[model samples]
Target chain A: MGGSLLEQLPLFLSYSNVSFLAQAFGVTVALSIVGCVVGYTVGALLAFIRNRHVVDVLPARFLSVGFSETFRRVPFLVKLMVVFFAFEVVGMRVSMFTVTATTVALAAAAFSAEIMRAGLEALPESQWDAAESMNMGGVMSLRLWALPQSWKVILSPALSFTVGLIKSTSIASQISVFELTYAAKVLNERGFSPVLSFGSLLVLYFLICYPLNLYARRLERQLERPRGWKSGAPLLAESEAA
Target chain B: MHYLEIDRFTASYDGKEQVLVDVSIQIAKGEIISLIGPSGSGKSSLLRGLMGLLVPQSGEVMLDGEKVDYTNRKSVKALRERLAIVFQQYNLFQNMDALRNVTVAPVKIRKRNAREVEEEATALLRKVGLGDKLHAYPDELSGGQQQRVAIARALALKPDILLLDEVTSALDPELVSEVLDAIRILAAEGMTMLMVSHEMALVREISTRVVMMDRGRVIEEGSADRIFDNPRTRRCQAFVGKILSH
Candidate 1:
């Protein structure tokens, strides 16, 4: 049996153990970022494909809708297991990290697609009508008006979702991917105190997520205030605020 | 050929309920024709359908000898290039200021020189009496001012015919005159316009012709005086009598 927690402190802080934990930390970060980046790109595509204003193909719309609805309803661990077993059934040999990362991206795509669709749909019909009357194509309409107007709606929630996604990456450890939670478990089994190992995860996760959440807030504030608008000024009527 | 010709045009908001049914009209160059009808009488739907916003299920529109096939990309493109519309709600891009709202379509869609478009847009805003409010956003302006900016935006496109859909109806009672004054400025220049208006006095003053609609059909049409003072159809007479008494 390992001695009291204080006695294990030296061993836990040993250079080799620190390096092992460092590698686990790196895996967690890489998994979250790569998965989320892929998720956002594909999710935005899914949202547009399903959008009636942009696409008219019935099958394409149905497929995206089905994918989003199916994946969003599934539990995260269940999704990881499904991906893992599906790869096994296909006779593909892949790393546990790859399996979990793919699950993160798939989950992200489904969730973010709904976020994007909500933002795009919230725009008034008049905005689209005005664009259509001018004969602006879908791309041109999005570029000129819809995107500029909807970015605040799309981006704030998306970035906040990213922070939540980073937390969800801890679940990857269950697949033996050596992410934060797995790193903590391995350390605890190797005679480090549970407090020392698990406590480190709480700190590291906070470190990874706090700045991202702050950045999201800052970006939201920037988008909310259009150029030439004075902060805290009352809306004027036919009078020069200048 | 007439400057604009719409024949037997029929359309529905949904595929089921026809908003405009067998509507027909003709306009020569430099004529201002007003569509005056009861609410939900398809005045706005006619303008929207003509622009291919509502998708005409069955109709033929010929503009300057080129038939607009709304299903065909090139035909719709050619149609839009020659026509512009000002919505009743003054649907300015909320992200843009008044000047940018006026200049965006010409510079972006038409690929006009930006500098030239800016100058023309400035002049157009000035023509509509919003010279001082060029930098203001839509929300920053009064309802009357926003409508004028919308007018400037449509004018900057230099459409062969402008369709104004109740341009001043959304304004407050006091604000209505300012927007109407701007329309009078356009009328004085002899701009070809198809307008839907609740302002009977202005319609009578500027319309070369007036068409009355009820239940999605053009029931009566003639000079503003003939339609307003001496309508032929009993329904039109009752409608005009109700409007005139107000």
Candidate 2:
């Protein structure tokens, strides 16, 4: 006698709150894009310090170590609360957009630094020796080769982290950012069935995250195979004869 | 007067135990010298010191009879352009194709046109017997092939002297001959060379002079025949005997 979950989807689609849902989608997309861009810029700077051992200054090293550890250890919700509360205390009446972006970016940067450090450490020492032998200076060597190679190594992990960051952005709703989860919560409280509301939110998160995960995996597969493999073996033999 | 001279050179990696101590050597304009020693006996350290990768604690490295100013960047770059090293590990940039790897420093550091550098790199690769493999990455090549490409890369700059650091040590037995053949051709062309290696047969055949090192010191130096057939120092004789046995 009860309609199936699939039948309920059409009813949900025709719900009067469809415009609100569309607005929530827009906010979610904007928050993720802005958060990732700002996060990557700040993270890259932090990664440089971690890579170059520039954190040699005791205070600077302490700050970096403390910032990374504190963010990593605390829950994302806690970070959002702290950031929002701290800004409120300072009497800076910032918009929810600014607060959400800043909180997510700061949290994302700590994780990015760790990912980059692992990538850097995986590089062979011989790369440095080769660069030095060619008389390449420190900055030029990093710019020309080291950074590019490190990016290749970290690509998959970085992409996965980005997906995690997208899901975590849901927590920003707790601070009244009105992102996807916030809209779903408001709708569910208004007599929409809890199962349908929560289930759709779960489906939305999967739809957003799945394609990116597949793309990252595809790239990893492509990278694992040497580029232009068809001519590789014979070319090796020919070079030996030359 | 020698073209390059290292006098009373003393160096160590952590400044505690010495790796190269009170070592002196002279390289002539167009002669091949081989340095043979047991592992960890400072042969590679001496070469690295000459390249300014490791600065000696108390000594002088004179190039063309003038003290080399390692502190000066321009001077160091100039010196490096005239000197090229082939490492045991080949050390080719794995990301680059063979031709690009060979041409990179020449084009970037020497301000040469990339197209012109590519032509030179092609010729050098051909000389090392790798003409067809220009576009292959280092990971795709065999150890011998990679080492030969390394030789080509070194030659691309037209260096005044070539330093070979156990170039064939990392190769399989079957692959060693190919790399050695490339080195033999380089020797025939009268390239001034300083080689640190364990291949006694190759050293005896190609080296004009052999320097036998032991415990951070040159225990003996003379013609390769004398060093191999009839070493004078007890240490030299024993070292040679052990290598010959293997």
Candidate 3:
């Protein structure tokens, strides 16, 4: 346990499947981007539906609640299995990439809806009144004013969700998606040490997610500060003096 | 018939317990009326009802001798477009600068040309004494400045009437005068206004007529001098006494 893991890392590098690593990295990055885009669109639609008062009426209410609960409560692996198997059974014949992207997006959409709803809820009621008094009608006010403000509050959570999404793509390897985890698994099975292969995979995830986390935190701090308090000395000195 | 009439109006958050009970009021063209009341006396609700933000359970709201139809979407839009509201909270759009907050609705909803809207917004902001703060966001402005921007936003549409719901309540005591001063300018220009305020001095100075509300009912109303100097009802007298002493 005390020995340097980097020393043992050469054994894995010696087997040197550079092309496989490159393919895995490309697939992982592609999957994350596609998944986040699809997730954000679906999440925004779901949030709109859930937040709408018209949905309180009958089947829509029940369906929305059921959709939210089912997607949120079910494990992503089970969702992956259902999606892959169902598509196969229906003679749809999708690639493993399609299945993984769809599953990750569906899972992320459920979580993102809650994040967006929280952002919308955090806005003051007075904003709506102001918009109305400006002669801004229903959807126009929401599109122009409310959503822009909501985006600021939702930014940090949305970034965190994207990081989770990058990690969750590993589970796609179980469905033979050829992402980073699959490459690691193949290397481990081909006589490379399990510790080295898995360790490298962990490092790759950290490299992807750590900077994102830092940026999100930085944004959160920037937004939390009162406006006009950012000039170098006098503002800081005034705040401190107060 | 009055230009605006709210007859036998009653409203409640929950339908059962009416917050504004059988309230009736009338405003003639180019008139500025101030609604003065204690907290929870339903001044805001009455204003909201007239704006069609709240539907009175049983009442007739007439605009220019025609019944104002609250249920019809187009009519509601027309009515709302003709009238504007300024809130106690200075509900200026936080993400936008003062100019944009004033110009957005004109450009988007009213479909006015962007250049013309900007010019109009700038002029209105200047009128409210916020010409220098035109590019500043609401969060970047002081409370008084934000309220003035709110006033500019309301004025941009050039609505037939402006409803002010305790517009000065959220201001610091020292800041209240700045907002009241802007409002006084609007009144002096003969902008028809229905102001719900707790500022007795400002109300006395600016309002042509004052209506005092108590327990959701219009307890007293007359020329500003009559109501301010010699109250007729015990409720009005008590209300005025409490406010004056404070």
Candidate 4:
């Protein structure tokens, strides 16, 4: 009297089942947003410190570069495991969710710092001269002039990294965090209907990630648009009446 | 008192090859001193040193009898407040429109009233013949317009001396005159200027003093008429002869 797989599809895709998945999806989205915000702020500060050569002492330079380089070279999953286990060994007693989010945030911060460093380097040396000639202080010059231009170089990669970070959060299931993937794993084990179960999981991730991918593409197009073309200034704008 | 005096200033990039060697010059108020030299002859580097863009290997810069201490933040800040530079590259902030480029430093760094700064920026833009392109970004404006905006940006600071480091060199031949026109107007207004230029004709016309440099030293320097027409050194004569022949 076993029902067909088709019959099981409705059971898995039902309102009650969908609601459960939605709740877990909500957690994933919330964690990603918070991680990204915290990560980006930390990353920007790190970039500023490094870019300004804030501390010229050899030890300070070595430590800053070493810290960032280590995080960048290490695999995210390995770093996550190490951080989680290290906290346990140290008897921190923090919640698994907190540890996982912090690890992701740290990882994201390191990457964004690297991205910002490259963006800053791409700017011309004359830019600093221009800023200095105006009697602008270092921080003020960086905020008003340097960051705005560097952000143009940073935006696309950063958004794309965010999408990847969202996907990577699925790994949180291993840490026993109640995200969408955890819910999916639980349902798949109970039903043993891998097709319907994993298929539904796929749909949920697609729902979240597809939009980001599309937006990233749109942003690329918008950014690549010729400099003055952003406001859709007409052909005659260049030759406008004096 | 000299408005600006560069005494025995020597500058180098890597401490290996000197860019400016014992270069000394004095500029009076309202004087347009044009630095003329062949490529790699340290014309721009001299201007940069005056702007505090380079550290002198030895020697000092004095503005109005006060020593400019490039190593001290406060002194350099004060030095910059009175001395602004317009680079050949324009170096306009690409993120902002022309008006913001002119207003940002004044309002943000100088802590001037924003509204007043904006008003002055608007007027400066107009004076540069960029009144119509006030909102244009650096990349949107033509090279001529961008350079003019850069000049306007420098003017926003109300500097006592304006350093023009080959400001028109990067412009196309047709676009060069627009930027030069802006500088000419500034000159007419009696703005104190130290310019490094290759436009021999324009330099001859506008300069109060002409300095000729070769191999990182000032070989000949005098009144524009004397340096161009009645040069003293063989180096200056040959330099003028080649330029005049062309």
Candidate 5:
């Protein structure tokens, strides 16, 4: 009744076609990169739109709040299925890759817009006052002072969200997009070995996401300062001063 | 003519409460006008009104006989370039080092020569006695140092009038004097300033004219010597007595 390493080795080796797995892995990565970059840009723009109290008329405010909320409430799987299938109803035929990437990007933008809004709001009013007094009010003030301070608040969460998006790419396999998970499913179907094929797939995902998690944690550590003092000696001190 | 005139300015935060009511003030060239009042007395509202950070329900700020149209963005921006403010909290830009914090607005917004602005910023930092801490971020500096950097940044704009809103109020007791000392230096050099301060001693020493405010109105206006020594109103006398005793 004991499981032997020798028996498992052949099962794993039998499905290891270098070219096929490599192609699937490449597609999965490309999808995630495209999703995150486009997602963050759109999300940042949405954050700005939602924050526009200066010119905030009723219609613009409602539209921004409504769109972000709707996207945030919808589940990613449902969103993906809707995009993949619904377009055909309107006489539009989009690629499986395009559909998957678009769905992930939309989901990511909703989440990130909220994160960026929170980050921007956390800044003190004095930051704006100081900029305005120096004749640097409006968009110039937001760009130079407010936005830069918000990056530390935005970066770690954004990166963690990106990792989640990468994992969620496996869902795209349901559309038969032939990313990593779909590749594993194909191998398992052919070889009649569920445990070996799926376990290796798990290992491959861990390999992709672990370093990202590490980097995010490192960034978080850099953000913490004790008694308003950052780690390490003061960067540039006059020789005579304390 | 008054160099800067604030005529019948009124300000409120929420509709329910009036923070400042029909406040008028005038300053000649090179006058250090200090606004002294108890908390919630609208000393800051007056300064905010002057900076165009707060819109007045009914009032006007005139600079050198020209009416400033606060509603117009171009007018306000042009007005603000001639006026700079340093807050009680310092509000230094944490993203950049000390030198860059002072240099950013001049180079970016004013479209000034970067090299010229950098050199002037360096000189300004040295004037504030931060000659050695040019590259230090706000987190790395003490409250006094950060406040000093803020002062230098304000000076870099070359404003015709400087507004300081309780600049030293946020500092630790020991740190307050260093910031006050920097202000003292500016006063000696004849910088025109309008300040809201609770530091009576510094205010008395630095102000050419001092105004006492209460309940959104100017209660008393006189020379600093008279206000501190012989206050006319019961409120001014009581306020001065209470602060001096402390």
Candidate 6:
């Protein structure tokens, strides 16, 4: 049997172990945040394609609906394998990290598209009518009037979804990506007790995610303030110069 | 060419259900033409169709001798730039204050100087009696005040023609006259206007011409005296009798 946790703690906290875990921790953070940014951009574009007032092309609408509907229904792990083998079958060698990150982005894009669609729908139909009648383009209406009004409806859910994606990045371990969960498993297999190995992971993940949870809650509170509490129509000025 | 012309126009919300069936009317510049009829008579649909809000299935809407092709973006944009409509719901941008709602299109879409637009918007708001409520959000204002903001917003565009789709219909009875007073100011100034209104008194007092519609077609139209006192069609007379009796 291994020595008591107190005695084993020093070896576990060695410089090499610490560095390896640090690298793994960095990977987890990068995967989630980068995935979210890429996911959101593509997702918003997908939403625009799906919007009748914006795209108005049936074929483009079909493609957008198909992408969101298909990706949203697939299990994340299955998506990871599909992506992994997709690269392999294409004869393109890619890193396991690339494979995992791509899967997270795929899942995030689908969910983010749906979330954004809901946000856009939250406004009254007349909002679009007013903008369209004013000769404001569909994209312009979204940026100036529609998106700003929908931020409160979108923010809480979007942040929460990002947090869920962060936790879900644990599944990246299945592909042998060097993220937190994989690091814990390696440490445990190397004779550290499961409690010490997994427990430390528990703390580290909490360290990374709790502040974000707090931040999401804070943002939700800020946005939950009554409508018209905003002092200005700032969105009107944002992209007009472009 | 007439300042605005809708000739044998047929339109639908969905392709199958014709809401504006063979609807045709014309407005000369500076004329206050009121559309009056029972609910679902498609009076409002004519204005919406002319804006390209409805699918124009047949006929034509010509402005200043240019035919409006609703399927063409530039044509629709040009049509909208020349004509602006205020809804009965007062579809002011809920995210904006009265002043911003009034100024957004002129400054952003029209690309006018922001300062000049604001100055004009402020004056327009004052004209509609919304000067005191310029900073107020739509949710913060009463129905009459909000509709006034919508009117000011529409006027800020400096359209060749202003369309009011039942502006007073959504108001509380006490709130109705404030909106009417604002429209009366426009009437006095000889602004080109097309309005769908149930306030027969306002329509009678301000409209040079009145068009009565029923089941997606214009049943009769003439000077207010002709339409109100002596409607030529049974549909028009029945509609006027039912509306006025209330």
Q: Which candidate is the best by DockQ?
A: 6
Backbone atom clashes (below 3 Å) for every candidate: 0, 3, 0, 0, 0, 0
* Candidate 5 lDDT over residue span A1-242, tens digit each: 13565675664564455567778888888888898789888888788777753234667657767878998888888889888777778888888999998888888888898888888777886787777777764577667667767777887888898889899989998889989999989877766366666876887788889889999999777765312222113312211132
What lDDT score belongs to each candidate, Candidate 1 first? 0.87, 0.81, 0.80, 0.82, 0.82, 0.87
Q: What is candidate 4's lDDT per residue for B1-246, written digit by digit as tens?
A: 888999889988766678899999999999999999788899988877777777678888898899988778788888888988999999988877888788777766776766677788889999989989988888788999999999999999999999999988899999999988898899999999999998887898889999999998999988888998899989889888998898
Query: Which candidate leads in TM-score?
Result: 6
DockQ scores for all predicted structures: 0.34, 0.25, 0.28, 0.34, 0.34, 0.45
Candidate 6 residues lying further than 4 Å off, grouped into runs, are: A225-242
Docking class of 1: acceptable
Candidate 1 lDDT over residue span B123-189, tens digit each = 8989889888888877789989999999998899899999999998898999999889988988999
How far out, in Å, is residue A228 in model 4?
Answer: 11
RMSD list, candidates in order: 4.9, 4.9, 6.6, 4.9, 5.0, 2.3
Candidate 5 on B1-246: residue-level lDDT in tens?
Answer: 998998888877654467889898999889999999899899988888777777567877899899999778788888888888888888887777888888787877777766677789888889888999988889889999999999999998999999998998888999998889899999999999999999888898989999999998999999999999999999999999999899
Q: Which digits, one per residue and each the tens of the lDDT, describe model 3 over residues B1-246?
A: 578888888877656778888888899978889999889998998887777666568878787777877777677777888888888888877767778788777767777766667788888989999888877888789999999998888888888889999998898989989998899899889999999998888888888789999788898989889997899998899888888888
Report the CAPRI category for model 5.
acceptable
Please tell me which model should have the higher lDDT, number 3 or number 4. Answer: 4
Over B6-92, each residue of candidate 6 has an lDDT whose tens digit, in order, gives: 999999998889998888888999899999888999988888888889988999888998888999989999899889999989987
- Candidate 3 error regions (>4 Å): A1-11, A14-16, A53-65, A88-91, A221-242, B14-16
Q: For residues B66-122, write the lDDT of model 2, one tens digit per residue.
A: 787776767777778778888889887766788878877776666676666777888
- Candidate 6 scores a C-alpha RMSD against the true structure in Å of 2.3
For model 6, what is the alpha-carbon lDDT of residue A19? 93
Q: For model 5, which pairs clash?
A: none
List model 1 lDDT by residue over A1-242, tens digit each. 37887888888888998898889899999999888988888998999888887776889999999999999999889999999999999999999988988888998999999998898898888878887788777777777777777888888888888888888888877777889899999988886888999998889889998998898889899888344422111222212222
Model 4 stretches with alpha carbons more than 4 Å out: A1-3, A14-16, A53-62, A224-242
Model 2: per-residue Cα lDDT at residue B72: 75
Candidate 1: DockQ?
A: 0.34
> By the DockQ metric, which is better: model 4 or model 6?
6
